[model samples]
Target: MVRNKLILAAAMLSSAALAAPAAAQNEQFIPILSYRTGAYAVNGVPYANGVADYYSLINERDGGINGVKLLVEECETGYATDKGVECYERLKGKGPTGAAFINPLSTGITFALTEKTTTDKIPIITMGYGRADSKNGAVFAYNFPLLGTYWSAADIAIQHIAKEVGGFDKLKGKKISLLYHDSPYGKEPIPMLQVLAKKYGFEFTPIPVTHPGVEQKSQWLAIRQNRPDYVLVWGWGVMNGTAVKEAAAVAYPRDKMIGVWWSGAEPDVTPAGDQAVGYKSLMLQHGAGKFLVHADIEKYVYARDKGASEPGKVGEVLYNRGMVNAMLGVEAIRKAQEKFGKKPLTGEQVRWGLENLNLSDARIKELGFEGMLKPIRISCSDHEGARDGRVQQWDGKGWKVISDWYTANQSETEPLVEEVSGKYAAEKNVKPRDCSKES
Candidate 1:
């Protein structure tokens, strides 16, 4: 009996010794704050799928970034700020590396988490949405707008409009109306738009629509009466479809309507049917369709029955956007591993990687994103990275690139960023970081 007991104890000890190292292996934890439920689900579902699937592809194909597995956990925010905050607080401390960074996805949630993430030393990537001034990284060190900001989007849209109308001088005496959501997200472009309007002598009108934007009959009626030369839409979720439908109802020429990136997804146009054809929106790097990355995702992720979204919806606009967002996150991790060792890294270390990101044409082509995205290089002073985008129009079937990539003139937008961000720093008693000393 004593010999039998000794043998069992020896076997158990051996098993534990073998399991210890495996359990101690490092993992990159990414917390996804998604809104897969509620009014925004139609738009949210595809995005969440793209974000999740890209991370899955990396893990399944390359065994994650540099052999450290990626661990992603989703917390549904239902598109509400309070729920988003709750989700962030719950998942910020999970996994081996502890929430490398967060893509708030929603401008409202981005605003709410800005202070918290700054204090926590975690980065918030608001790619294409959030406080425009957050592009001034000196004051907002923890916030990375990545591809573009609303200010940049607005600037690019205006450039497209100028091209359409002959030149910047042709914009003189023209009237442009902004039909926006009556929230911080919607109001973000107003300051920039105002600056441009004053510069080019275009009459700018600000129209507001309430949240979830289903009822915009009055707003559309105003547009009909005013007959503005161009209408810029800044809406999301059901608001997008409804805005397009209402514009059609008023017989507004679809070609004359331009929406921000968020307002141009599949969910935003399918309901508008043929009326949405020729409806243009800004494309922050990519529009939609299968790129080089999709082939690998199909083989490594969906083929294994591990796709986060339906196979058919893999390359839609928002889904592609999510994939790019996830790609940036993973690349930042890989860059950090180059400096901090090939192991899980803290949020601070990841921040350094993001600041130093240099996705050149060669690197992008190597990553299979060749024509899908413009090359970007982030610096301590420039968190918005590449302030360039293209115009895409929905063609009844899918989105098609309508204009050449237009780079937002930083000369026109930087002063505003500094003025607004400097004001914020003073109000909050925050000191802007000296990029000269960062190294």
Candidate 2:
């Protein structure tokens, strides 16, 4: 009887030892702050879905990076900055990984999180929208606005117009109006556009549209009276549809009206239907759903019933942008794994991964996303990988690329990035670290 007891005790001790290491191995937690129902729900929902779906794919397909399963906990922020802050505080204590990284899909949320992420050491992945200067990694270390900024977008749009008008000199005295939503996100492109206008000797018109811009009688009235040569729409959600309809009502030449990527999405166009034909928009990189990556996503995740959220929006423009968001997030994590040896990586380690993400064309194809995300090379000083973008046009049914990758005149933008980033850093009493050596 004593001998039998001894054997049972030995088995218990062995099991306990095995369980301790297993528990120690599992420590990574990834928090996803999403706003499925909000003023910007039309765009927010799909992007959030893409973010969550990529995490799901990573866990189920790859077995949780180096044995540490990625634990994704969603907190609805409703795209509100306060709610997003609350979500960040709530999720920051989940595990040792301490909120590996966060993708706050809203620009307001991105701004709010930018202030806090530095202390938390959790990188905020603002793939597209945010403070454009946050791309200066040395100034905003924890913020990664991966694909380019409003400044870049605005610059490219102007470049496209210049080429269309024969030359920059040919644009003299031409009127270009900005029909923008009256918000920080909407106003982001103005300074850059004005800078371009000054350089090219074009007239700049600023037209403000209220949030959820449905009541645009005055805005369209102004556009009609002014009769600007070109109209640039910077809006979101229902605002986009409203702008297009109002433009149509004014008999504005659809081709002459250009939209920022966010303004020309399916939800924006589908609501306006045939009226939005021939509308142009500056695509940050990818648009609509013509790329090969769209097919793969439709085949792999959506086909197997493993979509981010809604299965129906697998190939939509905003949906694909969400996919690109996921791609960047995953690639950053994978890059972290290469350095940190795998899962259960700290946020700082992941920040390093994000700051040095190098996605090649071949690798993009291998991951079932070739044309979705441009190959970005991040660094300690430069968090944005591809500062160049393209122009796309809506052809009633879908979008087609109209221009190739064009880098904005950085001589015009870099100083602005530094100035704004410097002001932010000064106000916050934070001295941005010099990353010259790392660069």
Candidate 3:
């Protein structure tokens, strides 16, 4: 009887091993590192929902990308860096394609995964947040900052403020305070802000808030006492709403305060109620409201009750951002298939596709995201294909676009990118890649 049982177990193990390769051959695995149950859950939930829905829409509508289905597995990180790294390790080698790319939603996680991805040969896409200097693709080959970076956001914020105050020349004697979350994510825009401060002759002050950012009485008190000309908020999750409430408490004009992209969502402002009215923020590309693609999602995924999020949240800002992120990932896979065949691709092949991504205006329109994203073309040297963003302001009811699309001043940004990334390369003893060698 013992020998018979052993033989049966061995037969089952052999059958499972045979089935694994067949299953892997038909799907592309994309690992989602998400934070849906933490201090940042208010913002993280919407983004995660959007991402999952987009993947669902692709499978339901297009029958997957070129018939190769996307198999996404979510690992909750709770916005913790250590947990995020663990999630990456656990899911990086799953399925056939093996993690097309990873979007480390938190800057802290992105920083932790930067070196790991380089060694593992997996691409890390930090759509709007990450190490700003990672834009220099020569030094950071496997990382893509995508649509925009913190440096560009800071530069655009300064530009908007300068325009409001007349000009860069008028920035002289002006005081701008940065109320940030006191983390690597919060400190990301400091170097660029300091550079702009020196150039425009404005006083720059950085005030930090502790994690979770519920207690900011002292920070707001400082802002009240200083009465800076404007306040730039670099916060996430609950921190955003709390800062707005404190600003209201101190009677600071909401119109004079601006937040980064992460701080401008419905959850960020809705908590402050009427106090958040007139608050402004930088838009990574698209703002809130449904677009063409959203209609499709509503028809194919939400209406059919196959959506990942609440049907009502089909087109919120973070939701739209998630759709855009998934769209980029899918397009990269499509591009990879152009060369590597329409089958499950390795992470290295996906990297090649990401590097060569060229989404024209017509292509974007065809994909039902015409007004949602600007035409982006990535190359070996320029991983951040688009640098332009618009400004939006929250009225009593909702957000409204206030400025035309503005491009980052690459003259100022490129030099800084080179300086910082070059220093990083030297410290890590990494030899920068030569783009010319690539076909």
lDDT of 3 at 358: 99
Candidate 3, residue 157: lDDT: 94
In order of appearance, the predictions have TM-scores of: 0.94, 0.90, 0.95
Task: Rank all candidate structures by their TM-score, best first, as comma-separated numbers.
Answer: 3, 1, 2
Q: Give per-residue CA lDDT, model 3, range 205-305, as digits (tens).
A: 99999999999999999999999999999999999999999999999999999999998989989989999999999999999998789889999987886
| Span of ten consecutive residues with least summed lDDT in model 3 | 1-10
Superposition error at 357 for model 2 (Å): 1.3
Alpha-carbon RMSD to native, per candidate: 7.6, 8.6, 6.5
Global fold similarity of model 1 (TM-score): 0.94
Please say which candidate is ahead in lDDT: 1 or 2: 1
The weakest ten consecutive residues by lDDT in model 2 span 1-10
Spell out the clash pairs found in candidate 3. Answer: none
For model 1, residues 305-376, the per-residue Cα lDDT tens digits are: 777777889899999999999999999989988899999899999999999999999999888888889889
In model 3, the runs with Cα more than 4 Å from the true position are 1-21
Question: What 10-residue stretch in candidate 1 is worst by lDDT?
Answer: 1-10
Runs off by more than 4 Å, candidate 1: 1-25
